[model samples]
Target: MHEKHKSHQVSGAHKWLKRSVAHKMFDRVPVVPDNFTIGETNDFLKTHIHEFETINYIYITDDTKKLKGILSVKDLFRKNPDVPVLLQAHQDLVVIYPETEQREAASLALRHNIKAVPVVDHEGKFLGAVTGDQILEILNREFREDVLRKAGIRRSHMMMDNILEIPLWTGIVHRLPWLLVGLGGGIVAAGLIARFEEILATNLILAAFIPLIVYIADAVGTQLEAFVIRDFSISRKLNFGKYFLKQFILVGTIGLILGGLIATVTNVLYPDSRIAFIIGIAVLGAVLSSLLTGLLIPFLFRNLRLDPANASGPIATILQDILSILIYFAIASRLLS
Candidate 1:
């Protein structure tokens, strides 16, 4: 990341490696010559430890700074320190380009258990290292951003999807089905809520949780929608049956944990086991059902030759809300009536 390393930039001055986040994230590493003996490397390290930003691995390079190998601190002070450092350092290494995406770099670091990913130029010259601490921060930040983006808020670029390029009538046709379906679904939802009017009056507390149940279901559906859309962009032939079966298991487990925790907490706070049981059971049902709507709507749109993201994103969110309400009230009425 320093000015001196700028000379090693690949393909003139405008290469991806020089411009990507990998360039900014890398830190100055402790480097040694490939021909140096272990004893000499140790002496150099003792004197220059403070000069390095990350010392997780000692990089071995040639006079031209072409990375040759690497060794841990333990390997540097092994029983025989007189041999050339390359004799002990690992040569077959996992590395990334300065142009590599931050998430990808973090993945490589985790997959190899290397703690850090070494950044190298096209010519195999070392640039620097993306350290362990940096990797963790990158992953954690991505996770939070992903959760917020998929559930809490959504950001979309219709231009990227070329929605404007399509003919107006055709676009309308693509979107119209969901709008009409949502209109009908909305009417059904309102009628259903009205049908539950007596249940609500009998236990007014039941009304307070309508938004929470709807949000929990919609949030889960939105996350799956975002993830599946992204996955399709990356690999179009991704197996949905595999994804479908896997979600049942994963979402089922999540439902059990969340349901039981809420049940336990509600019973303790409200001292009403029946309300707790009803709320917990309703939550589990909503979550499991949301998973189905999340996956199904996207595929349904794709089958109809429309953009799946368009359907699952904004147009069909009402589907999950409707489903959640149906599940919640159906369970509540059965138990209470």
Candidate 2:
């Protein structure tokens, strides 16, 4: 009989794992109708509190089973016994729908700093509560998924599955798509450089700064991409216009400082004021353009329902390189000519 019960329990857990929070996995903790007075609730809790997995908060509902408020156990014990539960209950409730994804429900709880989240039906009827223990499990699972995704691993693998156990061909298949796209971007970058061949030939010294411009711009872009990826993962409602304006101003200031340093150094070394001036302006433009590209591309990807991290790697690098080259040579051509 014990073995049979254990088998049933395992099957129930597996079924819950594959289903939503409404699937009887959540805790149906103590609930009191809002009409109950403090005295009545106190008597009810004394008898029934032990039945719940957690008695931190008691859900308050109306006759129709609609969620009305919540009362902390601490407040319940301290309040006047004759006071109505409604007077002492916290009416500003944070609730989740039963159909909500378990991970999303967990995220909401974490965001609001709530110990447990109440589940409600479409009509706002109380269902149950997703307790803190279940939330911990959901958060752990999501953390593993996020780490694997950032490492470019496939989601088909289980969180506890050993990476070394995966077949080499399966790993290759998961990684090959991005690599091919990166190869194509490299080809495009090569084409862009070839188009600027005349500027390179006329001012051979300009070729010397190509790697410098690309490297600095790539570095700045990578930093911005990292910030965007972290921020967007937590909150999707970022104000893009305000964010873009702030980044532009910040990058512009950095560009001016960098440009001045380059100008001072090149003016002393080159002995040609015109060439030094052109290089300084080109540096400023390249850096600003790279910063904007980095800030905007991630937002664009996010809007298109693609992972912004995809903007962080080869795609961002190649774009910054190509744009930096174009901006540098354009300034050089106008000033040096």
Evaluated with TM-score, which candidate comes out highest?
2
Give residue 197's lDDT in candidate 1 (0 to 100). Answer: 98
Question: Which tens-of-lDDT digit does each residue in 1-337 have in candidate 2?
Answer: 0011222011233444354666424444778888899999999888876567678788898988899999988889999999999889999988876556676677678888888889887899876788888888877876676565545555565356555987888767766765676678778777877877887788788778778888878877777777777677666588888888888898888888888898889889888787788778888888898765677877888899876765666556767888888888778777766
Clashing pairs in 1: 17-99
Error of 2 at 224 (Å): 3.6
Residue 299, candidate 1: C-alpha displacement in angstroms: 11
Estimated TM-score for each candidate:
0.53, 0.71
lDDT of 2 at 57: 88
Pairs of residues at least 3 apart in sequence or in different chains that clash in candidate 2:
none
Q: lDDT (CA) for every model shown?
A: 0.73, 0.75
Q: Summing lDDT over every window of 10 consecutive residues in candidate 1, give the lowest-scoring window.
A: 1-10
lDDT of 1 at 9: 21
Tens-place lDDT per residue, model 1, 1-337, is 1122333222232455432545445445678888889888888888877666677889898989888998988767663878889888899988877777676677677767887778888999887788888888777865654543333133331122356687787666544654676687788888889999999998888888888888887888877777765565444467879988887788888788878888888899888999999989988999898776777777776678654555564345777888889999999999998
